[model samples]
Target: MTMTRRYVQDLQDGETIEEVFLLVDKQLRANRNADLYLLATMRDKTGIINGLMWNVSEESMAQISAGDHVQIKGKVQLYQGSLQVIVTRITKVASDNLDPEDFQPTSSQNVSELLEQLKSRLLGIDDPQLRSLMECFLIDEDLMDSFSRAPAGVKAHHAYQGGLLEHVVRLMEMAWRIGDLYPEVDTNLLLAGVFLHDLGKVREMAFEGAFTYTDEGQLIGHLVIGVEMINEKVAEVEKLTNEPFPVETALRLKHLVLSHHGQYDYGSPKLPMTPEAIALHHLDNFDAKVHEFARSIEDDPNTDSHWTPFSPRLDRKLFKGAN
Candidate 1:
């Protein structure tokens, strides 16, 4: 029988069940206490649940590593108005028993729906060469599947499956709105840059169950990959015409991707120097930072002027509104 999911707050004196979860982070407890303990985040389709492995032993660690799929047997407990799992036993699921799709966190946006949205956005770009390059890959069934399934970032922001597309769509929306405000930012160029900025992320992440950076990603990172992607696509499209993709235009778009991080200290090789690049940088950061605050509010509800820790992605502190 499929395991019945019981939230950590739903336990009676002795209720038990098996659960699958993405272990966000893990480490050995400093003191070697009698009963080993593990803190992990458990989730199904609904949302995440705070879990605890109260009876963790060396045997448990031997079979499962962080980011592995496991069937944990535990009873739920409520503490300080929060729900937590008190694990009595755990079974590391074999690769044969586990399905990668079931364990990966996905977006609520239906795959078909999001794909349609992406196609529509692609059609909206006005540059002839940019549109052709976009059409080249967006029409491929296999590449489309991978792009939609990829996570936007390994962890920082838009970390859920299909998050890459979601983040791009959001950036596109912001770019369109910014276009309304400036009217001189060259909407076509800005739109093209926004869609392609994270396109290379599809190659950057290696998703077995939980998404993580591939060797290529760790070595060169997404910015460099994106610049390379633009160059290749430009070359492929240039074959159709005797003239090559305009050097200036390609440089402008590549510069935006490389500098979206905003500063040398923050992974950007150069700061956003162009008007379009500066706008993309701030809007992208705004969307990511806003979502970080949203996650913090969901996880920790006690909002009475607590000092939110520094958000590495936003490079700022998240402040919660008080009750």
Candidate 2:
């Protein structure tokens, strides 16, 4: 039976809650007086929250693991401008009793509909070689399935399921506008770059249970992985078309993947050198930054405040507008 439960995002300070949450991570820590406490990061579709249980025993830690769906009884409170729960009790919920859907955050966008739009946009590219290259990836059902399910990032912009697809589609929309404005820009190549730049994220991210990096993801990352993925598809395009893929075209596409991050400190292997590459870099940043700011305001638990807490990652507090 389906059940409605209070989600983490709806939690308010001073309110007591008893709800089940996905246990994303947990640590046993010692206080100054040597008392043990359990620090846990919990989630449920809406957002993630931290909970602290004071004077916990070793046996209590044995009751729950990082991926378990556990029932928590706690009081929500604001600490240092952020909200957290002071957990009084926690216990593992029987897996058979609750649906996992209640705990995973999915995209607000429809997956199948967005995918069709994505295919139509890519398939519409007039450049035969580029279209064939995109078809190579699109024809791979397994990869497309992963792409549709993967989050764009673990914590930043579009962190939920299907976020990668959403991010790419939004970029495609922007690419169309930008291409129209700059007639010199190759729209086909720009579209291909947009699709391929983050294709490696399907492999880079492991989203089956918890959103996190795969072992290969931590080692190589999406940029290098993306270049490799494009080469593999490029080979398929050549074999299928019975023609050699253009060397310069392939190199330029790879540049878009490697240089999309835009800077040395941001992990781009090469800086944007081409018109397409520079356009992609700025477009990607513009989308990601705007999403981060919007998400910050939406997820801010401080309803009474006009500004969100200073984000160390973003390095600035977002204005929430006059309340």
Candidate 3:
């Protein structure tokens, strides 16, 4: 049967939809009445919508899993100010029947062009040891490919394909301008810190199907993994140069990665200690928060409201006004 697919962004309350979406997440839960229901997050390239399949049989629940592409028949409704799908029927679609592009959300920027800009900016660093350390990562074809494609996060910010590259490049641009404002800030070190701050996210997220955490990501977290990556690369750079990478330089760089989250509760093992580390934290936060705010404004489905609903992450409703 030919089905008219509606993208999540275009879905409206009270509309019946027959669409193919990637089942990005699924869980079976018993409600207060002890009846099992399938709770799922369905996605297409445009966005995600939560789905509830009531009166789901055990066999039906067993047949579907996260990462599967399924054809779903559902009705859209507004739940708690968010759009949700009340799924009535679902069937797994074979891989050959689906187009991969319809499932993944990607950054609007050109991936290759953003990557070149990143490399060109990194090449501007004149500190020999730091440059050599950066080279260790840049030259690895496998790592670069993953780095180019990985998301900055699973959900926090820049959570789309090629988002890591986009986030890093944006941070670097901010760092370059901010670094010049304070003579106390070391431009080369600050830029290096910005470039390497989220390096571990390339490993932390699995993007082959949906953006989800790897076992390593859940267990070790990106900060520690990033520090480990830095140490491994530092060792290689020292071996290649036949000279020890400067101890203080390596320590400072590692510090930046470890403390980029800025606080202990936020997941940083250590708070930002060095000047560069502190600046990296602020710049990273600024970029991520601004993106979240802008995205909230753009993605809000309410056409009549002039203000976005309160964002738990931001703790305030954003006014959509030109003033």
Candidate 4:
């Protein structure tokens, strides 16, 4: 029998649902009585919902993995003011029957339009050497495709298809305005830094179905990988010009990528030491933190309250005022 599918956003409380969902996360837990249960996060393009499988057997738990599309039978209910599914049955759907497009979320903005905005901003750089460096990245069709599709992170911020492009374009726009206010900042270097800061994420994440860190991402992280990418591109620029790229200019650009995180503990090996690096760090942080807070408010399931539940990341509740 073919069951009617309900997207996560459309599910209502007290409804019995039989649908196919992407298994975004799954884990085994013990109940108070020492019985094992399955805890999972089921998702579709619209959103994700928590799920619980009571009295789950080891054999049943072994049948599925995160990122698999599965047929699920469940009842939707409210738990702690949040929607959760009490799953009764789950079976993995065969790969041939699955269409991954239904599971990946995408940005509201147009991808091509966003890419064009980024290109136009990069082209405005007056420094010939810096513009050449930027050109090397934009000219690569493969890298641009990856950039357009890559997510800014697995979950923290801009974690959707085309999210990387959205985040970068927003950051560039903000950096441009801030550079005007502070003329001391090197606009070319600052803009270039904003463009390159998260470029490594294209390789660091696997976004074909679900967002997850690649093996290299876990081992080395994006900052170091990005620095390596800059070096390779700088070498190419030098070969094309038949002369070495300026040492100070290359060092400054690399510093922005390496130090955008702001502190040693925050993941930066070196702290922001230049005007452009400092501006890049703050601008990047402002964009990411604002998005995180806004997303938290939107994702909050408590429709009856003015405040969202405490976010462990933000360490406080957010006010969702009608005003």
Q: After superposition, how far is residue 230 of candidate 2 from its true place, in Å?
A: 1.2
Candidate 3 lDDT, 1-323, residue by residue in tens: 34566889999999888888899998899999999999998888899889999988788788888899988898999886679999999888898967799889999999999999999889889998899888899998999999999989777688899999999999999888876588798989999999889999888879999788899999998888899999999989889999988999989999999999999899988998888989999999999999988888988887788888877878899898752
For candidate 2, lDDT tens digit of each residue in 1-323?
A: 11557888777889988888888888999999999999999988899999999999898789899888888898999997788999999998787877778778999999999999899999999988888899899999999999999999988999999999999999999999877789888888889999989989999989887787889899999999999998898888899999999999999999999999999999998999999999999999999999999999999988888999999989989999886
Q: Assess candidate 4 and give its lDDT.
A: 0.89
Cα displacement (angstroms), candidate 3, residue 138, comes to 0.3
Model 1 global lDDT (CA atoms, 0 to 1): 0.71
Distance (Å) between predicted and true CA of 252, model 3?
0.5
Best by TM-score: 3
Compose the digit string of candidate 1's lDDT tens values, residues 1-323: 15554433344443556666655445445345555677766544334565667555665567666666667777766455345677766666665755555556777678777778768877878788778877866766776788888878766677778888888888887788778789868778787888777777887888656566788999998899999988877787788665677889989989989999898988999899898888888888888877767865555423444645555545666666554
By summed lDDT, the worst window of 10 consecutive residues in model 4 runs over 1-10
Q: Show model 2 residue runs off by greater than 4 Å.
A: 1-4, 30-36, 57-59
Per-candidate TM equals: 0.78, 0.94, 0.97, 0.93
Worst 10 residues of 1 by lDDT: 5-14
Choose the strongest candidate by lDDT.
2
* lDDT of candidates 1 onward, in order: 0.71, 0.91, 0.89, 0.89
How much RMSD separates candidate 2 from the native structure? 2.1
Across 1-323, the per-residue lDDT of candidate 4 in tens digits comes to 14455777788889998888888888999989999999988878878788999999888789899888888888999886568999999888886866676788899999999999999999999999899999998988999999999989887899899998999999999988887789999999988999999999988998887688889899999999999999999998888888888999999988999999999989999999999999999999999999999988887767678998776778888999864
Which residue runs of candidate 4 sit more than 4 Å off their true CA positions? Answer: 1-4, 30-35, 95-99
